[model samples]
Target: MVDTSDLLPKTPRYLKVPLIILNTILWLLGIVLVACGGYALSKLSHLDDIINVSLPAGIIVIGVFFLVLTVVGCVVAYKEKLVGLVFYTVFMLILLVCLIGVGGGAFSYRNDAAKPIGTAWDKATNDERNIAQEFFDCCCWTDANSTCGSNCQVVNETGSVVPNLNKTTCNITVVDYVQKNLYVAGAAGVTVGVIEFISMLFALFLIVRICKNPRPKSYD
Candidate 1:
């Protein structure tokens, strides 16, 4: 029955607004990352599209998880309760794991994907000398009565004929681009998804901790 009001400091007026804003932003980012990850997963068949559309999305989404963890930790630390302290500690640990997981995923994907692109670029560049204008000749191959190159342009990820003269034949270049990006993004998406899930876990922990702990009475 002893009064507990004096045990805790008055909550700061400035703190709550920032915490709420941060929490909302972090949550939004996590949600976006998941959505982008899903989109990337869905576009698995189209490597170029996957890379173009999904990789950056995954990175952003994953990056949000770290931000969320930071916000949650800040809130708990500022509050100065046993539950808050515990939540903060746990969240930091989770953030560490997420950092490593996402970093490794991105690194691994980039490394693996780079090799193929290097090869393709080398092949394309070397072959370009022999067939200097072949790419340009094939432009608009999809159109009727368009004849530029005698050899058929390579098929790309989209199943369209490569149709550029100045650039890599559209399909080959695109397929190569997509293939490389997809590899990189696949790794990235996995990492981001893991991070987001971990952030959510921390958020859950925070909620539970807050609910279970006793709050100090407003008046002393």
Candidate 2:
């Protein structure tokens, strides 16, 4: 009888070719995600309006930092080098931070930002409120409204009369500035969320592919 052992096929000495291909794709995706985040961060400074909060600063710093690391990681991956572990670890952590900031900023802005503006609107006379409401309706939550939600209503006192547009109390520029900043914040929050999701997916793919590949039999 023929020797059965000699008839069996040898197992691959390294990762399967398909898994290596998938890992390479994942590494490329990670590079794209990180690069997009960097572009968003760099463009932030040029935007017409931005909230001067730690959030934007953090985004800019972290985003750029990850971008550099990801680019290096891509070069390493192309060599079929085992750098996915490092890339996935760093990216996963970065995604967590981004998710937190995005969720917090969006929730807080919707609640907290409206409070002062709404209160001011409510304290103003109907005419003033109407004007302020118009501003809010047109500006404060324009992005949200586009998605079918009601815009922020300026808070106005029920019986107060509209204040005169005297030079002392009226500053339309200030209101306009606030509106622009709010819009910027909302857009940034949404963008951060999207980037975070993409980052997360790439991280997962890299980690999964890394895990699937065992050490070569030669190493054993």
Candidate 3:
């Protein structure tokens, strides 16, 4: 079923060698992304509605894409197949679009990233609030400190425990943390986008190189 007319391209040592090395790094990165996302999903499935679960899910998707591409890329480079190279080049372009979209979307939604957390805080039970208060080292839901849980002592309550009021509020602290991290994610997306664009250019140039100097099928 082989095409008798199929030809292999002459690849430069400099280009081919670096491509292979970068592919290895990309392969390992793919595995890490999948594993990290899977762990987060398993451990914190309960936070799906409370937090943006899409982040981990998106990581998994990207990881799978990279893993699949690594195989196609390796084969194309090894066999010098024109068809496979075309697919690889197209996939890289698709990935570039994806990275840009993710970066832009995250930046646009940076301010809204903590809305769900704030809502969750408003609906949280005293036990839940106490846990958050202990973690964030804050009292109640707002600066009012009107709703102290066991984590923070109540003024009128009589017990062996002394009242310990924190100056900050839990809602403010939690929202600030989420917003800051979301901004970081947005920035990371843009950085990765630039790196990917350069990698894509390498693939594009390889295509042109192959087309210009392809060897006859019998030459190999």
Best model per TM-score: 3
TM-score of each: 0.39, 0.41, 0.72
Q: Please, what are the lDDT tens digits per residue for candidate 2 over residues 122-214?
A: 344434433433433433322222111122333347854333232222223334554555455556545544544554454445444544654
For residues 1-220, could you state the per-residue lDDT of candidate 3 as single tens digits?
A: 8884434345543455555666666777678768866775665465444456687677678778978887777767666676787788788788768767766876776767556676776666767667667666777666554555676764455555544554587667767765675566567657655655665666666667677777578956
lDDT computed for candidate 1: 0.48
Residue pairs with backbone atoms closer than 3 Å in model 1 (clashes):
33-61, 48-178, 135-164, 135-165, 136-165, 162-170, 162-171, 163-170
Clashing pairs in 3: none
Query: How would you encode candidate 1's per-residue C-alpha lDDT over 74-128 as one tens digit per residue?
Result: 5663563456646655664665465556556655655465454334333443234
lDDT of each: 0.48, 0.44, 0.66
Q: Ten residues in a row with the worst lDDT in model 3?
A: 4-13
Q: Candidate 2, which ten residues in sequence have the lowest lDDT sum? A: 141-150
Answer with 1 or 2, whichever has the higher TM-score: 2
Q: Which ranges of candidate 2 are over 4 A from the true structure?
A: 1-52, 114-176, 214-220
Clashing pairs in 2: 118-155, 121-155, 121-156, 122-155, 122-156, 122-157, 123-156, 123-157
